[model samples]
Target: MAFRQTVGKFLGNHAETNENHLDVSLQTHYYKTTKDRALTVLRNFFEKNEKFRINAVSNERGEVSASIIKGKKAFIVGTVIMVRPHQTVVDFSVTTESAFPFDFGYSTKVIHRLYDHMDKELPTIPKTNR
Candidate 1:
């Protein structure tokens, strides 16, 4: 079984007039793991998970782009960085394609679900030196 926890700060959220989309970004809570391991775990999750399809990836840049085309279409891009030794930061930007002017906070829910998935999937360690 995977351990589940919500860890991340919502950076911002807004709608793009040009594209008619709602998007939000979140900074995951600090993790005591290497950048490579973090990126690989996310990549594997996105690739194998039925909900998401890996669109593009750059291991060197620590980025992964994916899309979920279920009930609502969403484009997701995640970036991983090692801010401190054994501490990795993963940022995610999720954009949902919608026709309505407002999504009734649907975009935010998507981000939260994504974070939940990460919390369960990613490795866990003692929250020390944070």
Candidate 2:
């Protein structure tokens, strides 16, 4: 990682998952399930968490937005999209609300924590499976 990127990773309050994420753990994840099912599980995931206050959910847009009030307030958006039958992709965007520009990689850690739960709740499709 570049010096700036290294600094940003620690000094930025925002983190997002995508296909081209520099961090391997931050890469988009795929599950062997329909988009609807994946989204439903995601919705339930947020609903069951008291720290998370769901703001909006749009099935048509394939995204769920929520604010988590833990140590610091943070907004998160999780997206589930279907590429084909029984193949769904999941991604997340998180931004912590803080006076400082950085959150000490808190956003990235949140994504990882979410992915850990999602991997157990949903059947993940390995690269070989796809």
Candidate 3:
């Protein structure tokens, strides 16, 4: 698996007035498994966030688009699963076009923790088989 990280601007009104943009980026991995399994993990994570809403779901393309709204501030996150017979990787991002009057560090940390929790919790198979 190949992973790349880069900072870019988010385009939208969700950004804060002072900063009005975010450093958009992602951490990706190549897994030796099926893509559907990986996507199930990601989907479950976003579903846990009450503020997050799924704007789209496409199983054939293996993509999910979602957004989180807090007051007037909003953040958009999306993930796409790329699968081959022997490998899979998820590409994802979090972005906001506007900067609200809030702590960027805290906001970003919260989002990061949610992502981490999803990565940790969603992928494992249940011990009790149906």
Task: After superposing candidate 3 on the true structure, give the runs of residues whose Cα lies further than 4 Å from its correct spot.
Answer: 1-25, 99-111, 122-130
Residue 107, candidate 1: C-alpha displacement in angstroms: 2.0
Off by over 4 Å in 1: 1-27, 123-128
The pairs that clash in candidate 3 are 14-98, 15-97, 15-98, 15-99, 16-98, 16-99, 16-100
Q: Which ten residues in a row have the lowest lDDT in candidate 2?
A: 1-10
- What is the C-alpha lDDT profile of model 2 across 1-130, one tens digit per residue? 6688778988999999998787788999999999999999999989999889899999998999999976689999999899999999999999999999889999999999899988999999987777
Decide which is better by lDDT, 2 or 3. Answer: 2
Better of 1 and 3 by lDDT: 1
lDDT of 3 by residue, 24-69 (tens): 3223444555777766776776687676777777778877777766
Per-candidate TM equals 0.71, 0.95, 0.55
Q: After superposition, how far is residue 84 of candidate 3 from its true place, in Å?
A: 2.9
Model 1: per-residue lDDT, tens digit, 1-130?
Answer: 1122111112223221111122223335556689998888888888777888899999889899888877777788878888788878777777766675445555567666766766786765434545
TM-score of candidate 1 to 2 decimals: 0.71
Q: Candidate 2 regions off by >4 Å?
A: none
The lDDT of each candidate is: 0.65, 0.92, 0.50
